[model samples]
Target: MQLPDGLDVGLYPIEGFTNPEEQPEGNGFFITSRYARNGITFGDKYNRAKADSIQAQFSSLYYGNYELDVSSEEKTPVDFSAYKERVADSINFVIEVARKYEERDLKLLNKPMETKAEFNRKHEYILKDYPNAFVNYDYRGYTVYINSGKRLYHFWGRNAKDSGEKSQTTEMQVRKSEPEVLSLLNRFRPRKLYEVPTEQGFCLPYGFIAGDSGHEPRNIGITYRLQNHPDVTIFFQDLGMKPKAGKEDDLNEKDYVIWLWNWQYQWSAVSKELIKPKWRSIEMDGRKGVGTFVKSVYKDGGLNYGYVAYVQGDRQARNLKPDLLLYVMQDSRQARGNPPMDKDELEKLAEHIVSSIKRR
Candidate 1:
């Protein structure tokens, strides 16, 4: 199988189309070195926060895994005069938001903290450098809001909770201004590019540019299997299923498939049977996985074929973040009047896809 023009190996601090709204179809998903966010490689300096709000809940940062939320928006064309004011306001808004949060934190903890430091934020961001190009750094991380005339970007990673505190070192800051060990309490950036959380971003294949869904969180569009293979259905997901029994933070291959099956076909109204009870053994990207594939009929007698599985040793699908979810689901229940892919053909397709899986 030929690789797409851009494969989402996902190695960047922030990534998305330069102007997703303008780049129609699957074109915007490509991330050349130009757009890759290779900031703070996962290690001692790397940190994440316990996300408590909506913005924090859907953040994307570079830890060990690359999971970012995806989004798109149409920016109204504006002259530089008006755009400058908006940019300044955008920066001010970020500073004010920061101040508000710090003040609230101080109040709740009964600690004395100053909420003023908007000036320092401006200096840290170095606004003079704008109208030039993108700014990136591994050291001296700056979390600010930017409006690039065409695109709106939000970045907040490893920031100072209390604006009054000064730091001599350039690294991840904690609740108060002080360097500490890794803790989710330290919020990551507003902290992602395009439309993604700090740890849950996704990309589309260039091949799918024909008609595949661009970047919708639900039911990402389909792409061609190859020059000859017209379609190899892809079911992309980023954290929307909870595991059975509150005992686990994530769901395994079997559970994930079952959840997806019920969700998509729940309305069919039938006692569906899953390969659960016992999942078949499968290997992907040299990793072991429990997998299952079968054909089931809905109460309305609609036929469906599906294959679901998760990498065994890899991080299972989490309810909050994206992880190793390796299932080449051959579901064909959509688009009425289509026959289910034959089992033997499905197995060959799975083997081919599984073998193609590799760490880029």
Candidate 2:
């Protein structure tokens, strides 16, 4: 079947089963049980088994089978049936985990998922007593109160950090005790900091981009507020060096320093149609040349966000390519803030990031 563009075709063989009743849809092979006993339906068992199998695959991919065995408290024989059951159980657990993960991910996708326009109305009561106090979506999964300016005061959600899965629902908790809002604002800090070196002779920290709640911890196309100046941020990197076409000054705008291995293969595959026109090139550290792109986003009636893309190369042999990088980077920027960048901004940022790479 035709898959979405940029999906790793190599991964198709691993997609596993969508549901148990249907045959394994892709190139991968999976087992199904038809026994209908003890109120055990074929479809139910099938689904459970499939979920277990997918979890097993994910576990194996992330934590090696050996690692899983070491960390697992249940030690059992490695005979065929035993091994199969073990794997199946792991997959089942993963499926259960995935269901909850999807719920939390959905919450982030739609900030304040349940509470609607009534939120503004109900919030007015709190606003009356605490005038600067307002509720805004926090990290995609919880509600947070900001008081007296943009200070974070109270937040509500499960603390899922220790457990790779969502925690049980909890009540609203105050971030700070002060009825004053600004007092609470200082508690929240940016989780990731990126230092982007551009040819323009400046290395600036690109602040507060975005991240994906679905993936748990990966930050995508992280946009940053331009701190006094606009700079580029490189999301992907190739590890080999290509021959320099000419003196750095003589290098054309289209020429880029790429990992030789990627230049020969991967760079050709990235889509350029989504790139914004504002992108341009800049010199890097007065020594090497790099590609750069920028996008500006306006929200609440003003320009509040910008995305920068940069590329750099060091003499080495490794796998790196703009297209492949873009595939991994496509949605990472959603993690940083609430009221996330709209689809158009996201697409433009993705395109600009991919297009900034050039072949020498």
Candidate 3:
């Protein structure tokens, strides 16, 4: 099977079932990277076509799995046979999850998996008591903790009220509040640029222009005058799913507009939580980068949303703020149809555009 452009498949060795002879004929257990929160453990008659390797390969960083010990679960223990039935029932959902993970949008379903730093920061006090404890997986909105030896698994989250023998878990009912609209775009005096940056800031420095002329920098409109900043020039394109009742120049679904904002200054940390659950930190040329999808719905029947992909670096003159930020905002889904570009495609396009930026 052909994988997505940036995705790869790996064959993880399921413990005990590693040997074809030791396996239960066609029956075996498999789990996804999202097994913790999504509660997706699949079991089915193994197909040779799906089995790419017999020795187990660590081919993809986004997914890996090992045999699950379903019988040992003290809380609502489920036998292997029953578990297989459940997997069969949710096969479609499981497949969808796998597809989305491959597209790098798994966080839209559950919160992004906690990085090591994040896990430690939230569980410092608990870890002090059990220094040997380590995180295994975040299942069902709870952090599963395992001992240093990896012999035990415990669930922990916002409330670590439930304690288990050899398993210390936190149990509580918590709901995530929707994030507020960032409102940063509204603050900008917009413009558009089709050509790659030819000078300093976040574009190709002293390089030939690229992309079609239609995409080159141009006036958003005479009405939305470009606001001149003493230190840097800000270019942006308005991203609205639908034009207001009387506003003719407002961007609409058919316009196929991809708003790119290029500005340079000293960089400050951007809070990922403010964007959405789909955001992730990235790195480019040793500089911090961030990317995410944003959607906001208005009670008055208006919608504002898009994908954001940007990178920041200090590669300019010392006196001037060296940080450069390149952002792209695409219109949200419209009543007419899906946006011109989906989150994944929009991010890739933005990354390519930003790649033109260079240091003086």
Candidate 4:
């Protein structure tokens, strides 16, 4: 008798016995069947109701196209007759004794809580009986049992590997949920312009609002980020300032610092076609500087205007560097279709901010 997949039962053929015998205690969820028997009998492992349910389901699969002949005990002959009724009623029947055991196993596998009591009740016996059996944990909310000899195993989940063998256990990390990006943004309230004093030097912005500043100090330098505008990011980094392991022989006296401005307007990449970057030379606080201006029509039918400037410091501070950068970028979309500054006005603002850096 053949059994369906995921039935959680075992089949063993007997050489001379004519009927089936249940041996749940012998090796596995076992069934010993004769080579040529046409029917089977359930063992004490299964109750009458459980056996009947499996029998009805198994019998219902044979109602079409071929005829059943019970006279031959070996195999059911498939004869296409006018009745066209196919049936496995006579071929053979796998004992349904294991079905009752599975009902108990189901309750154990799908228990509400994964507590010590539930695990002890369901798995203590298996572990005790099969000394070589090992339990593999899946931190993604499941467990698998691999028996000895690498021959059999079971999994606990909605999609279980009820009958299978595996070579080894696979390690995995727990899959955790992530926080919403909007919630993180909502936590960032705007702050007034303040002097951001660093170990290198002190710098301040003019009439700008600050948000969360993710800062980290390292051996070589300090790096940080400040939220600005609606979607713009202001990044600051100082190098050749902090003491590290490899700096013992490093005598190069030039320090490097940078300010990167990332403008995230409500515009697609296609807006680049309409907007052009214009670069010009200027001076700030007796230091030379370069300015870049950009303006364009956004994909969302809004206007964007911005300016960026890289100004040279009057004298390189021991902590910071010889250069500084400033950005005054904004879009009509972020300002509710009304911008207070134009391109030239933004360039002046950026230059003024860069020129205001104090090296103390």
TM-scores for all predictions: 0.42, 0.20, 0.22, 0.28
TM-score leaderboard ranking: 1, 4, 3, 2
lDDT of 4: 0.30
- Of 3 and 4, the candidate ranking higher by lDDT: 4
Per-model CA lDDT versus the true structure: 0.37, 0.27, 0.27, 0.30
The TM-score that candidate 2 achieves is: 0.20
RMSD of 3: 24.6
Q: List residue ranges in candidate 4 displaced over 4 A.
A: 1-269, 273-277, 283-287, 311-323, 337-340
Top candidate on lDDT is: 1
- Model 4, span 235-255: residue lDDT tens: 221221233322212322111
lDDT of 3: 0.27
Predicted model with the maximum TM-score? 1
Pull out the clashing pairs in model 4.
Answer: 64-86, 66-85, 66-86
Candidate 4, position 26, lDDT = 26
